[model samples]
Target: MCNRRRRVDLIEPSVVGTRNVLNACLKAKAKRVVVVSSIGAVIVNPNWPKDQAMDEECWSDRDSCKTTKNYYCLGKTIAESEAFEYAKRGELDIVTVCPSIVIGTMLQPTINSSSLLLLTMLKENFVDSMHVYHDSFTEVDDCEKLSSEKLQDLGWKYRPLEESIVDSVMNYEERGLLLKK
Candidate 1:
């Protein structure tokens, strides 16, 4: 089950959940317990430029988290640390997937509500209408291009932002959605 919230103090619950799952896995003698995590777990605001790439050794700084910046990274760091601790304790086999800004087809209509909103906003130049942000954005197709092959070598694949947007738009159109313009 996915848990989403802004509470910085709620890391305890995640730790507890991991413990329970690890315990169950150990009791069951499971071979693996793959954990879905985020790249944010590592790579929190180091000296690296935005264009720089990060790898498994990277780790986000929870101490730098604030209401304005790094909160998500902080939570991810704490949760991932807990998972690592569990793994070190030899509770069960653990693997993790760390993707940035997951976007793509939703298995259920309820998921990825943000991608849908982004598509709706883009369909009519809503950003331009609001005069609230940058001028001229990357096309959806362009945004999803990433080092998928590189990540795949590590047993990971990211849904490019472009692919997610296009898929969302097509899905919406198939569902009878129409562009206002």
Candidate 2:
């Protein structure tokens, strides 16, 4: 899912892999399953009311995503949709958590896509060319703010945003991936 190089590459892992995981969960008789979706799946729709805050109810238009060539969003939407459909069969309880751009200290030696994005922004002249395919893929101008209200209601706690950024930067510096500035 992290690889945005090819649209074709996204289909197998996101859609098929998600279904396989759900099937395995059903077979295992798991009581509850949580699928980590992305905000990309929720807020990518242009049809959402401008003044209304997007919530779990909102779904990105799949056709719109395809027309715009936003494969990442398309993949996430399809995967999440399939997950809900599987859950609707009433075999197992399924919950989908859609998080916005996550930034935190790295647990592994290598950097991940989110951290890499933060790194690119932190460092000057990181890439030769940056092509933004569409505004919806990168930004959500209509919504007032991205909310964690749903997660908060579930008693999920997160570290402060400042702490996350600082920790990530420190981790990058310690790993010699980023020079101390």
Candidate 3:
């Protein structure tokens, strides 16, 4: 039988959770284990370079994240540390994947705070309004490719950001909310 588990954000408590699960899998003598992490674990850039081609090697600096940079990023670093520790124990066959900002449709009518913020920023011209990424933005296709790399590191392809925005807007429209003109 195959089993699966998921923990999205790498919070401090997740260390314990990950350990518990991995330990169980080991005790159960599971065949495979896969862990989903974030690229932020390696790439801790507050202002992630838009032009640079980021890959798996880059890691975000946890110490810097602790020093008023961003809490979410710090959590990711801590979580990643826990994951590495688990993998080091050699108790489970673990594959870790790190992805950038994940954007898309909300499964529910009300979206999460982060997703809502991203949706608002993208659809309402607020990104342009705030000048946040006036120069560049990450597309969903690219994000999906990154996600694919995180899990499999292959067979994932890139798509333009505009296409992602269009898809997201259309998704929201299905819920009777017009995101953009």
The model with the greatest TM-score is 2
TM-scores for the candidates: 0.60, 0.78, 0.59
lDDT of predicted model 1 = 0.60
Across 67-168, the per-residue lDDT of candidate 1 in tens digits comes to 435555676777777778877888666876676654545556653535555555655554332232532345464222223355578775555655666675
Count of backbone clashes for each model? 5, 0, 7
User: lDDT: which candidate is best?
Assistant: 2
Of candidates 3 and 2, the better by TM-score: 2
- Compose the digit string of candidate 2's lDDT tens values, residues 1-181: 5445678787657888888999999889899999988887887888977677778888889989988888878999999999998778887799998877778778767776787788877665332212222222244565445567888898989987657766776777678777634
Candidate 2 Cα deviation (angstroms), residue 115 = 1.2
C-alpha root-mean-square deviation, each candidate: 7.1, 7.0, 9.4
Q: Tell me the lDDT of model 1 at 148.
A: 38
Candidate 3 total steric clashes: 7
Candidate 1: which stretches are off by over 4 Å?
1-24, 47-52, 66-69, 112-117, 120-150, 154-164, 172-181
Q: Is candidate 2 or candidate 3 better by lDDT?
A: 2
- Positional deviation of 4 in candidate 3, in angstroms? 33
